[model samples]
Target: MKYLFAILHKLRPLFPQSLVNYGYHFPKAYLAARLYGNPGADLEIIGVTGTDGKTTTSTLIYHILKTARKKVALISTVDAKIGRKNLSTGLHVTSPNPFTLQALLRRMRSQKIRYVVLEVTSHGLDQFRIYPLHPVIAVLTNITHEHLDYHRTMGAYMTAKLRLFKSAKHAVVNKDLPLFGEINARLPKVMFSTYSLHESSQLKPDNIKYFQDHTTFTLGNTFYSIPLTGEYNLYNVLAAISTALLLHVHQSDIKRALMSFKGVKGRLESIENKRGLHTYVDFAHTPGALRAVLTNLRSLKKPAEQLIVIFGAALWVVSLVVYGKRLLSNLIVLKLST
Candidate 1:
């Protein structure tokens, strides 16, 4: 990507237009309508977004919805599975083109799928790729600093995420974040529902418990727990469970689905845990993502236990950090507060 950018710089003089210059660019919805028409019109699109856990939540939602025998088209970072057309992440979908997204949604709609769960990223939202699909249920996992360069500031990054709730009829959020109240206050007309550590008195869900083998939680009179570990998964699972119940999937089915879920790839995934010293790893490369994983581990740690953090990055971010070694050290000491 850096090499491509360097080459583009050299050729900038010959070409008189910016690489991404779009003149009166058609909104994704319009392009979607023109090419793929409208698939999300009848199907409920539940958009899941945040710094982390989106893939897990989305997969869980897809499982429960699929278990209930509802057709679903899923577009997540892990993969894009629309009906029988399931493809791996290696497929061309890192920020899908407007027409491609519209076509996918339209395909799902054509298959008579009842639901679609799209994992919306800040970059995808910023690009107006999904402008056509007005989600019925928007699930915001949580927000933290991740895409600072692209967004320029945390505020702009947040604004990109808020675009999900802009058209959603019911927005589900993790109200535990410090920014939750501020974010909710600025949104458009929508019925707000929240999933949190603190159970809402008005909401149906009452007490919740996170267990090693299975997490048992109650909403109204019924108790539910899927076979899963990690406290973060519990919260993310609940977010999906809450959304599923709201969609009126049977409590028994929901319970069954969670119990049987095998889990998603690369999410707090077990790599190699040696004697007492667990070397658990994840695909967390961004500052916010690193913070989220660290926070979860910190919460899970026993008192007096030491938590060691060694930072590294993917190829691109690694280059950035390597090139800006002095800046990185200064920022770590001054700007990053944990």
Candidate 2:
């Protein structure tokens, strides 16, 4: 089966996409799940999917659940956590293949974890890499221009994202995006709990303020001041809050979790120094994410200080065209390399 998978991967370009997706990926995932006793079946999973903010949102939800003293695990692009163990899923992989995923779930099951926050990608959903592992709660951060090489069109990409919500008992969505209307129209409205930074939503943050070190926002009468900054992160926080609330976590626990949360690694990570230099390292590869990161950094810089950006591109990722356009407009340092 491994050899056949290798051969199919090599000849993938010649075959029809549907065949590659269903015939190859789906069967492999199905077999792997069966082999592993379908460990995900015993877990209450929270699946977070979108072009960006998936890792941050998933981590936030995991943190909240952990703080609330729920037996929770996490699988994101960053890494996977099972009880006290931290496992590396893979490099540059959002959702692992079925075998790896099933193994992780099995480990989680052994640890008696009751809940899991899994980050889902469009490619993962389309290829059925996480087959038969239905999420109890599905969260859609937002859809944007991403993974066009595999999906070929926005409609197909959206369709892939829609698959996550199909089986979920509840969905927490970002109502600010244009995709919200289509999702609301297609899916049952009662299944949805929404958050928005703009316009009305079930979870909207009022009196929002952004700072270099942290951000403050209000949801109803409760005030939240989180360590993570940027307006983009506010959406992530709200999504996490919505999911936590759905799980029946108290507002006080949520606030405590957010306040103590240091933030996701390699995501707006800050380097502290006494030399009056503000430097951050982030894994913002997408155009939309890049824009948001630079915008946040620019806001923190003084008028006389220049924001130096040393841009690096991964060989497998093709984001240069749109990425370059955004960088050029910023007039910052554009040191490009593959």
Candidate 3:
């Protein structure tokens, strides 16, 4: 399948972009999944897609389902798991090509896996990479400025995300984001639930507290805590918990699973050292993600402590440029105050 795509890519210059997309890419992917025995139809699949937190949210959902004694699998940017077997993706892409994805799902189905949690990306949705598999539950963490380089506009980017909801039986959305209204308006045909920091949301958090090593918050009268610090993480937890509730997992089990989750790597991962200086490594690439991570780190530091940040630029150069200037200006202010 990949060989065919490679050959087509070489001839891509001779064809229109739409022709390559609809004529070649979509058909090739769909047929590959069909050849794989249509594995997606054998299990309940949960797809989590958004600008940020897809990996973390998917991982958390997988963990919770596993803790509930369900035979489950996880496919995320960090790794893919089927029971005891773990495979590193070895690539930066969140969603793999259709051939790779379908093959993995076939393996899981053969092992009698009951549920599969997948991290869906806008690119995958737009390209029809996750073809032919309708999700049982779809989750949207939140939409922000991202992937404009490919989609060309926020409306197009959002439309790509909305594709997931269309095929899903149920959806869990972040009510705190302004996009919630738009998403809700389009979900009349799909059963959906919402979570938020606001009091009116179906799943809302209260009595939030952040510590250097962990965060604690209350969902209803039940207290939950995780060893991941930051308000953004709190939102990720909300999404996971909401999904679990919709799946009929008990509250006690949800709390237990959350307490045991160490967290996903490269997402605000902390490093220890002999010196007292604190450091963290995070995969926050978008402007919204960068701001969230930086704000969380800043809140963790003492007034006299220096907060240093290093970033890598790859895709989304426009967002990086805008964030870079703003970050530098803020750093200068911090320096002047010190």
Candidate 4:
């Protein structure tokens, strides 16, 4: 493929249109089909889709699988990896088209990966960019007010995300959430199991400490810990741990993986210390997401430390592009006039 692209690059001057056509199309579809279609590449695809927690949950799944010693590939909003190679052709957490997705899967096939975790988006589904692929297991993390402009309503948004269950062999749902009923209803043919990160029975966290920039939670027993903060992340890890258990992974291995799973980039990513304020750059755009993040930050912060969110009206940057839905792209960029 590199040779093919190189040869095409050499021949671009002679047959620009021919080479352009192939690059623009055919590859993601052709490569996905060639590598995974028909017989479908023998790789397991686990699609994680929801308004939030998809990235964290997807990463958690990948890390747990890696600890279990299975070769894995993942496509999240932040990055794409085939085994260990990062295949981020774009800076944003999305694939502009399906071809890119297919092409990446082709690379994964060559890596001899046994598992593939894809962060599926409603936008990707809406645009038909995720076709020609099947997820053996689908995880519905949660749903909130997001991507309304693209789907036009909460109902439409829910429908778009539910397609994960529609396309998977087994669907994993957060049973604590009310939205799961509708999603489960839509997946009449698909097998599903529920799991919760929320404290149930004897599996709750032993203790938790929250700071403005950092939060740590002790994993039920021993000295192991989940090295981030937020109730949402608790659910994310619970979802990942449940999937790991479903895959028949050992508890020891899952615990080991969870300890190492820090977080995804820009999802409340700390930008070092700016003066005295602990600045954080989060990939939150929607109303629900923003509210959750701010609330989490407040809960995690020390009593003495104050949090003054300086979004600078960057909300629309994520809404319109990240999820590919126009959730009223209204931003208020702050500038001190000279």
* Cα RMSD for candidates in order: 5.6, 3.1, 3.0, 7.2
Over 4 Å off, model 2: 314-338
Q: After superposition, how far is residue 307 of candidate 3 from its true place, in Å?
A: 0.6
lDDT of 4 by residue, 209-308 (tens): 5554344655555444677677777778777877787788888998788777767888878676758666778877665566667778776667777666
Structure candidate 3, residue pairs in collision:
none
lDDT (Cα atoms) of all candidates against the true structure: 0.70, 0.88, 0.85, 0.70
Top of the candidates by lDDT? 2
Model 1 residue 3 distance off true place after TM-score fit, in angstroms: 22
lDDT per residue (tens digit) for residues 1-338 in model 1: 34654565476546423233232123333645665656567778899888777888998999999888887878888788877778654453544666667767777777788788888888777767677678889888888766665676789889888888898888888877789779878974788877776645224344555443456767668777666655567768878977887798997888888878977766666555557664555665655555556566665566777666555532345345344533443344234323
Regarding TM-score, does 3 or 4 come out ahead? 3
Work out the TM-score per prediction: 0.77, 0.92, 0.92, 0.77
Error of 4 at 16 (Å): 32
Q: Candidate 4 clash total? A: 5
Candidate 4: stretches off by over 4 Å? 1-40, 93-96, 197-224, 274-277, 314-338
- Clashing residue pairs found in predicted model 4: 36-40, 77-93, 211-300, 212-301, 313-332
User: Tens digits of per-residue lDDT for model 3 on 56-111?
Assistant: 99999999999999899999999899989888755887888888899999999999
Look at candidate 4 and tell me the lDDT of residue 278: 66
